[model samples]
Structures are given as structure tokens and as C-alpha cells.
Target: MAKQVAKTNAVRLIEQQKIPYELLSYQVEEGQPVDGISASEKIGYSYEYVYKTLVTTVGKSQYYVFVVPVAKELDLKKAAKVVGQKKIEMIAVKELLGVTGYVRGGCSPIGMKKLFPTYIDESAETLDFMIFSAGKVGMSLKLAPHDLVKACKGNFADIVS
Candidate 1:
């Protein structure tokens, strides 16, 4: 019998929308770092197809989500401009769970505590499909970029460095 994959909020949301996606799960050591690049390698996917989700805040409140390629960095200035914010900084790692209901390496643009404005890197717009964390570490969701954006109500922007 094949091992079963538990449904995460991200996966559940995708299914609820009737969006097609592939769920990928990989082994993770107790202390092994499970970053985006590591996840891509384990999943047999290229860096281009894997993305990382980041959460940024304008001040004490007002959070936003940004999804970018695994190999690129989120250019804060460009990100702020795209979101109509004068300045924004990544939400502290310690605050991630409280703010987005996801811990580091497990954050997904979908199924957050609240639906914040979301943006996907323009680089993803051309890809047939993109993958990101499935609301859990060592798990990812693969789907068409356009479908992802529609599911999350996100826009594409040049927000990477």
C-alpha cells in the first residue's frame, strides 16, 4: 500500500477551489535544513519551478505575502512599491506563526490566518507550473502559475532581486 499524504490547509483550499495540483512530500531529518533549494532537489524539480513564500509587514499591522523563485531574493524596495507601501520589512521569524499561521520553511501563500494581499514574482508568470510549500515543511504543491495566482487572488510583479 502506498503511504498516505495528509491534507494541509493549503492542499484543502486548492481542492475546494477545484484547482488541479500535485502534492509532493519528502523525507526530512530532525535537524536538517529544509529550505526551498533543498526541497527542489529532494523533489527532483529545478529551482525555476520551486518558489518560497515570504511575509512582510508595513508596520505593526498590515501584512503581505510574496512568492518568489527559490534562487532569487525579494527586493524590498520593489516589493514595497508593488504593494503601494512606502516601506516594508519581513515579518520576524518568531512572528511568522502568529501572523500567518505558518512556521518557517512551511509557509504557503494560501490558507493563511487571514487573506492578505499577495504577489508572485513576474518570473513565475511564464512558467507552466510553479511549486511552493504546502503549509508544511517537506511538502509542496505543484500547479499552474496562473491557477495559483487565481486561487490566492494574487498579482504578478517584478519583486525579486
Candidate 2:
């Protein structure tokens, strides 16, 4: 089931953009996984090049998506300001699942239930490319930052602390 979901998202993105990407698979043990951190090491990619997907709520009326390197933490104040909101808080795992239609470790910027507004940490811009979960744990996709921004309609923000 997990494989099917990831495949669907990958296919959708491919058909949508017709862009080139590499699918990376790694051994991922379930049950309390370390998520993005574990994935970075397992896939032999530097943590700096791997972005973690985070869900957050703003002003009690808006939900936003955040993509940041695991090496940094989400700075809510900075993120809120970037989005023109005064307050922001992390979304619960259940709400995140409902919003993204993907489990905690697998939630991705693409293939979400709704096309929530997205922001990628400014640090990502420094990289030639970045990697993120391909809608499942144990799988990831490698692509250019500009392509990500295009595919996600992502806005750049200094949302990492």
C-alpha cells in the first residue's frame, strides 16, 4: 500500500512536469523511526541537502507547509512573518495526516490532499538541488530547487533557525 501511494505521487509529479528525477530507496525500519534524519543517513545524502516537510497552522484560520533541512529547527516567528501572519504553531500529527493524506514520516510537499501554501527555507536556495521524501518513508526524490519551487509553487522564506 505504501509503495503504491508513493508510486502514484511520483507518477503524478512526473506527468505534471515531465522533469527528470532520481528515485532513491533505502532500508527503513518502522516503529519509532527517526524520520528525515534516518533517511538522510540511510540514503547516504548529507542532511543539509535533505529537506523535511513540516505542517503548521497560522492565525487559527490558515494551514501552511514548511520545508527545511533537518539540521535546523522551524522558527515560527520568522515563518509567520514571511507568510504575513502574526502567529504560527505546529500542526498535530493527525491533522498533518489529514491535510497531506500521508503519514508522519512520509508527508511530502507534493501530492498533498490540498495545495496548501508552501515555504522552503532560504538555506535550500544555497543548494544546487535538494531531496525530500517521495510520499513514503524509505523513498526519496532528488531534484533541483527551482524545479521544486515550480512544482510546489513554493515561496522562499527564512523559516529555519
Candidate 2 stretches with Cα past 4 Å from truth are: 1-6, 59-61
lDDT of each: 0.94, 0.82
lDDT of 2 by residue, 1-161 (tens): 46543484744775589877788878765576766777898999888899999999965557899999987899999988888888899998877776678888877898888888999988888788899978887778888887888888888888987
lDDT, model 2: 0.82
Error of 2 at 54 (Å): 0.5
Per-residue accuracy of model 1 over 10-81 as CA lDDT, tens digit each: 999999999999999889999877888888999999988999999999888899999999899999999999
Which residue runs of candidate 1 sit more than 4 Å off their true CA positions? none
What RMSD does model 2 have?
A: 2.8
Q: Among all windows of ten consecutive residues in candidate 1, which has the lowest summed lDDT?
A: 30-39
